[model samples]
Target: MAEITAAAVKELRERSGAGMMDCKKALAENGGDTEAAMDWLRTKGLAAAAKKSSRTAAEGLVGVAVAGTKGVAVEVNSQTDFVAKNEIFQSFVRDVTALAMDVNDIDALKGATMPQGGSVEDVLTANIATIGENQVLRRMKRIEVAQGAVIPYVHNAAAPGMGKIGVLVALESDAGVDVLEPLGKQLAQHVAAAFPLALDETGLDQDILERERAIATEKAAESGKPADIIAKMVEGSVKKFAKENALLSQPIVHDGKTPVADVVAKAAKDAGASIKLVDYVRFQLGEGIEKEESDFAAEVAAAAGISKG
Candidate 1:
């Protein structure tokens, strides 16, 4: 057998755009012949998959799975919406979500033994080959309940029980799981729709608070009001902003007449048990990716051999 060195792997990776380990393995399996290694990668469809990796995969699904007292949410992205609707892709995402429920740490989840047959990485590689598109297992979060249950909600439709947005809510209490699960799911749906910035006032990001304060200060200064009055106005606006954008401080969606904190209190009273809203996780598909905007008219004219008007 020929020697498979780091230099050989690097050369193959630069040619194929495959991951380092994958390139090394390809070279080793092909007897350290660069041409054979490239052929091997192309034969496995890995090179084609790697070529598409740089494409923006902002369109995909948010998957959720709840197992007993624990729940997990996952986002798997693809280059096109059509691929997002693929049954195989949806199944892969569902299985990955369940894996997330079993493993709390993200790195551990990535390396966790896949439910199918091999390691998680191996499964991803196989999916890339089978799916004919670049795919990513982007994020996962686990929610657990000490006493009650963790509930899930998904918006839109990418799968049977998954969608574009997924939320997980953990309710900790001694109440019957049968009673709390429905209410928890409703709250999770609310969170997905409302897009709350924080769980409550206390959980609001400090930088967001500062930005609001600055905006309020600028607006108040323009009024030429007295210093004390300006200060009071800024404080009032800040308080209102915090309340409106935070989950627990906002009105409950089910009733729309009471704040979420108060709704939790009422739930506890009605359930004949003390239920605490411990924590929650919400994942919106493509929340932060910068989408590219194409100039459609210009492209059309160019294709038709016409000069710009």
Candidate 2:
């Protein structure tokens, strides 16, 4: 066995884009030879997988799972939507989502062990290499309530518990499942439909509030109203924006008039149990990633020495 120095591992990482531990192991297995270590990484498919890491992965599913009081949502992205329906890819997502309930966050979930073998990330890299598409374990979120239930809802479901929109609603109550489940399902549906920015005005981003304020002030200033009246008008506008964007203040999706907070209160009243909407999480597939718009015909024309136009 040869001694694996820090410099050797660093160089291997630079060459392979493999993690530090993997690079060190590669060096140790290859007798501290940089070239041999690089070979080992490529043979393991990790290097090949990392090479495709730069590709945009904006299509995939949002997987949701609930275990009693706790629920988790995980987004796994692939370069194309076709992979979203692939059994191998879908199985990985479902397993990862269930696994995410045991971990703290995305990093932990990736490092956590899967039932088959190796870390969640290891399987992911292997899948990427074999599947020949860039895949990303984008994010995971877990929600729980002490005395109540955490309900999961999947909209546009590709399978049982995974879909384009995954939502988890945590209710803190001693109410029976009979009452909590229906209420939670309704709220989760509303959450999917309404796309609330936050649970309440306080949870909303200050930057968002300020931006709305500025817009309202600009519009109101055009009215040429008195300063105090304009200030009041701006305040009202901002409040309306907050109410419209915050989940707790927004009108219920079904009836379209009752506020969410009031709906919860009414449910609690009817159930004869004190129910509180603790928290919720909504994960929409490819919510933030920018997708490329390519013109394949033009590229083919250019390559074939013909004009497309």
TM-scores of the candidates are 0.76, 0.80
The residue-by-residue lDDT of candidate 1 on 1-309, one tens digit each, is: 889977679767877888898898899898998766775775555664111112232888988888878888888888788988888888788777777777867678779887777877678778889988888778888878767888888876656668888888989988987778888977887887667788889999897787667767766787899999999999997898889888888887777768888888988999889898888888888766755555799899999999997
lDDT string, candidate 2, 1-309, tens digits: 888878668756876788999999988888888765765675565564121112232789999999889999999999888999999999999999989999998999999998899999999999999899989999999999888999999998999999889999999999999999999999999998888889998998897787667767766787889999999998998898888988999999999999999999999999899999989998888875767656799888999999877
**TM-score of model 1 vs. true structure:** 0.76
Model 2 scores worst on lDDT over the 10 consecutive residues at: 48-57
Model 1 Cα shift for residue 40 (angstroms)? 55
- Top TM-score model: 2
**Candidate 2 TM-score versus the reference:** 0.80
Candidate 1, superposed: residue stretches over 4 Å from native: 1-57, 295-309
Q: Indicate the residue-level lDDT of 9 in model 2.
A: 83
